[model samples]
Target: MARIIHALSEIAQDYDALFCDLWGCVHDGVRALPEAVAALQDYRANGGSVVLVTNAPRQRASVQRQIEELGVPADAWDSIATSGDAARAALFTGAVGRKVWFVGQPHDEVFFEPMKLIEDPVAIERVALDEAEGIVCCGPFDPHAHPDEMRPQLEAAKARGLPLLCANPDVVVDRGESREWCAGALADLYEHMGGRSLYFGKPHAPIYDLARRRLTALEKDIPDARILCVGDGIATDVKGALGEDLDSIFIAGGLAAAETKTEKDPDPDALHAYLQREKIAPTYAMGKLR
Candidate 1:
């Protein structure tokens, strides 16, 4: 069973670096979590390095700006690595088709910038599914639309046997006090419909490998055992850490808070049952990252 702690201070000395999740662990969709920010600051103040690892569909610069706007202190982390960064790298390898059907928010158009640098650039065309060679999905084309409403397009793409490149693999994230669907949810649907979807984020090695590289660049010769991943999503964060052989700290008050906690404290029995059901074992479980 994972130890339940109130603050990261209790185990801060155990790790040399932290690959912290930005969305639910550091802040909700709307604002920064003061205690979470303080925990990172405290960790860094003690000579450990912190790298903000996110599955955000936007690039690092865009994510940095959003975090700053949300009041995340610049000193809280030493570097940032995103799934978008890894996805761009994968896109450059020329395995995916040149002409792609882009599906995501308009702001996520930033993902296509790197394609312009390649000799034979991948052209992003928002065309009918039949006209496209491949599909690149970042997130919901319409965040307010339900999954059922988005199925017809996915069905059409599936019929064409187009490969989907998913930038962010999170199914749902906590936005303030509410939960919202993400690209992973759509990807799940696509797969259920016999469509192939390629994920570039957590629970997959690409993003974790990128985060480790960023952390190593900041702190020379850091080993995987010395790095601790902290996040709220079990499938993404905890499973990702396990995949990379790194220890993980599960934040119960974030995405899984509704099922894992009673009031503000973790309900031990419920938390245990949930973790057991999910078949994941985090090194530690805390009410919050604080």
Candidate 2:
């Protein structure tokens, strides 16, 4: 069972650091949540470190730029660990073969940029699906369209035995009241349709490893017991924390607001039912990040 809390300050002293999710917890896609930002700033001021662990399918630098534009200040976090960086390393090492087909928006083309870290990297080429050996997905070409629309392409890739490298494992994200489909929806469909798909983000081990590396780079050797994972995602954030054997604080006000009946706090009965359905138990639950 998950204990519902009113604010992060109630247990802030117990953790030395936080692995916080960005999209729905800290920000709502359009701008930073002021209360959430204040809570993080106060935590850092009191000597606690914050690592913004995100499943955004873009480079850390790119995420930084986007968050800055969306009103997230620099003082709120100590470091960043993005799904893009982890996936990029795998992509460069030939996780998806040389000639591949890409399925994403124009902005996601940066995924093909040269990597300086991988030694003797594979020479990747973005070619047509007919000429490609694998598929790389950052997101859907049209985020608003239904996932079923991608069936034709996925079937073709399955017949050719092409594996999909999913940059983000989130099925959907609420971008300021407008929900949008993500790359994971397509990858899930592909796997369901008998094609292979690879994931490096939340609920997967690779991104957690990348987050620990980010923590080490900052000289913070905080133990597992002293670290807390905070996010709104039940499957991605909370599940990832459980898989890593870390305590988690689920923000019910983010993605599961309706299911949990959250406004200022979650309705206990509703939250209990929702958690029971998902079969995931976080250490704590809050209406919002604050």
TM-score of each prediction: 0.95, 0.99
Kindly report which residue pairs in candidate 1 clash with one another. 7-290
Model 2 lDDT, full chain set: 0.95
lDDT of 1: 0.85
Error of 2 at 178 (Å): 0.4
Model 2, 153-255: lDDT tens digits are 8999999999999999999999999999999999999999999999999989999999999999999999999999999999999999999999999999999
Top-TM-score structure, candidate number? 2
lDDT of 1 by residue, 1-290 (tens): 88888788989898999999999889998999898999999999999999898999877888999999999999999999898878877766654576778889888989877644357654445566678888888888876677677788888888888898889999998788677888888889899989999988998998888888887777556888889999998999999999999999998887888799635668999899989999999999998888
For this target, which candidate reaches the highest lDDT against the unseen true structure? 2
